[model samples]
Each structure stands twice: as structure tokens, then as C-alpha cells.
Target: MAKVDILNTKGQNVETLELNDNIFSLEPHKDLMYRYLDMQLTNSRAGTASTKTRSEVRGGGRKPWAQKHTGRARAGSIRSPLFRKGGVIFGPKPRDFNKKLNKKMKRLALKSALSLRLSEGNMIILDDISFDTPKTKSMKEVLSALDLTSKKVLMLLPYKEEKYENVKLSAKNISKIKVIIADNPNQGKTNVDGLNLFDLINNEKIILTKDMVKKIEEVLV
Candidate 1:
């Protein structure tokens, strides 16, 4: 088990939390993390880029000129790749870019990413995050108190509901700061299941609420 100090909004250490070794103290699997990241990025691609091939272009039914008769080189369809306004050759076409990993592999990769952050001392445990109103200044004050104003941060909340809506709004406008909810009320998904390797590795620091930590351990254990 590894212990970390839990900080309040004012940057004061309120208590220490014992983390699950299985999730936060294991050796990081660099290769798995890379594969996980690659999978995520690949899956996110729209894959909508397309180009017309010579056969797909219009007005290519008739050859531009007789072959070998004119002074110019042998002529073909106007849509030939060698001619101007011609269709592309071996060009990109719309296709699926999704990549799939087994559930076990995804879990292991997420744990590896979390452990890497913990080992690097880039994980911050927060007692709670609350906002009375959707105000950016309040979020900035908390970040300032934690001395993370300019740091790239990823904050995870346990749930997305009315209670956390203000907190989400407060942090949305801050550059380099991303806020994600572990679970949505309507989805009924386990909180820690929402943790992904990409956000875990992309951010310089991770801020997890106490509830979020427990939720993560419950799932990852």
C-alpha cells in the first residue's frame, strides 16, 4: 500500500489516504500504455478523408486524344492521374480506424498509467471539489492554492450530476486543465471504468477526489 496526502481546496493537508498497490504502486507497462494510447487515438479518427480515383471521376469515358498519333505523348482519359484535374492514385478513402483491446489489457494499461503518475509524484489527492456557482475564478483560486495554476492538470470526479455541474463549469475555461467525470448517472457504469490511458498520460498532473480514489480502487482491485 502507498499513502498520499489529501489536500483541501485551500491547499491544506486534511488527511492521508492509503492507495491500492495493485492500481497505484505496480510497475508501469510502457509497451501496453503505448498500445493503449495508439488504440485511443486511432479510434478517435473520423476516417472521413476521401479522394476520387481515376475510375470514379466524371468525363473519363472518352480518351482525350488518339494514342501515338499527335505530337504529344500517348493520351488517355482526361481523368488520368498524369493529367491535370485528374483523380488521385492510391488516395485515401473513408474507412473505419477503430482499434480494439481486450478488457484485461485495457485494465492493465490503465493501472500502469496510474502507477506511473504516482511514481513520478504527479498525482494529487483532493478531499473534495465543490463550487457554489459556475465561476472560473473559484477554480483558479483552488489551483493557485495548490500551486498548479500553470500546470497541465487532469481532474477526475466520481460522478456527473447537479452537484458536480458547477465544478465542471468552473474548470472548463481554464487552459491546460481538463475535467472528466468517472461515471454518468444515466449510464450506470462503474466509476473507475471511465479511466483511460490517454488522459492519464497526457496531463502533467492528476487530481483525484477522495471519492474518485475509492471508486478507482473498487474497480481496479
Candidate 2:
């Protein structure tokens, strides 16, 4: 187990939290993390790039000129790849770029990423954070108090319900902060499936409530 300080919104340490060794203290798997990142980036691609081939181009029904008769080189369809404004050769076409990693591998990768952050001392366990209404100023004050106003922060809430809507809305306008849920209560079990590896690794800091930590440990352990 690893002990970490749980800080309040005012940047004061309210308590210490014991982290699960399985999730936060293990040695990071660099290769697995890389693979997960690659898979994520690959799956996110639109893959909608397309180009017209010679056969698909318009106005290419007949030969442009007789072959070998005129002073110009042998002529073919106007849409020939060699001609100006002609179709492309071996051009790109729409296709899937999705990459899949097994559930076990994904879970391991997430653990690795989390462990990496913890080892880097960039993970912050918040005692609690919320808002009565959606207000960016309130969120900014909290971040300032934590001395993370300019840092790229990833905040994980335990659930994404009406109760947390204000918190989510408050953090949305912050350009460097990203908010995500750690678990979905409707799933009826401990499911930390909402954790995103990209956000975890890309952000410079992480902030999560104690409940969110429990939810992550319940599933990851």
C-alpha cells in the first residue's frame, strides 16, 4: 500500500489515503501503455479520406487523342493519372483504423498509467469537490487554491448523475482541465470502465475524490 495526502479545496491536507498496490504502486508497464495509447489513437481516426481513381473520375469515357499520330505523346483518357486534373493512382480510400486490445490488457494498461502518474507525484486525491451550481469562477478558485490553475488536470468523479452535473459543468470551460466519471452506478457493479488512458497519461495531474478511488480499486484490484 502507498499513502498519499488527501487535500481539501484550500490546498490543506485533510487526511492521508492508502492506495491499492495493485493499481497505484505496481511497476508501470511501458509497453502495454504504449500499445493502449496506439490503440486509442488508431480507433479515434475518422478514416474518411478518399480519392478518385482513374476509373472513377468523370469525363474519361473516350480517348483524348489518337495514339502516336500527333506530335504529342500517346494520349489516353482525360482522367488518366498522368494528365493534369486527372484521377489519383493508388490513392487512399475510406477504411477502418480500429485496433482492439483485450479487456485484461486494457485494465493492465490503465493500471500502468495510473501507477506512472503516482510514481511521478502528479496524482492528487481530493477530499471532496462539488458545486451548488455550474460556475467557472468557483472551479477556478479551487484550482488556484490547489496551485493547479495552469496545470493540465484530469478530475475523476465517482458517477455522472444530476448530483455531479454542476461539478462537470464548472470544470468544462477550463481549457486545461478534463472531467470524467470513474464508474457508472447504473451498471450495478464496480466498473471503472470510464477511465480513459489517454486522459490519464496526457494530463499533468489527476484529481479524484475518495469515493472515486474506492471505485477504481474495487474494479482494478
Predictions in order: lDDT: 0.88, 0.88
**Stretches > 4 Å off in candidate 2:** 185-193
Residue 217, candidate 1: alpha-carbon lDDT: 85
lDDT of 1 by residue, 1-221 (tens): 89999999999999999999999998998888888899999999999999999888876578778887589888768888897778899999999999999988888999999999999999999999888789999999999999999899999998776667788889889988888887845555554336788889889999999999998888778
For model 1, name the residue pairs that clash: none
What TM-score does prediction 2 earn?
0.93
lDDT computed for candidate 1 = 0.88
TM-score against native, each model: 0.93, 0.93
Cα lDDT tens digits, model 2, 100-208, are: 9998999999999989899999999988888888999999999999999889999999976655668888988889998886656655655344788999988999998
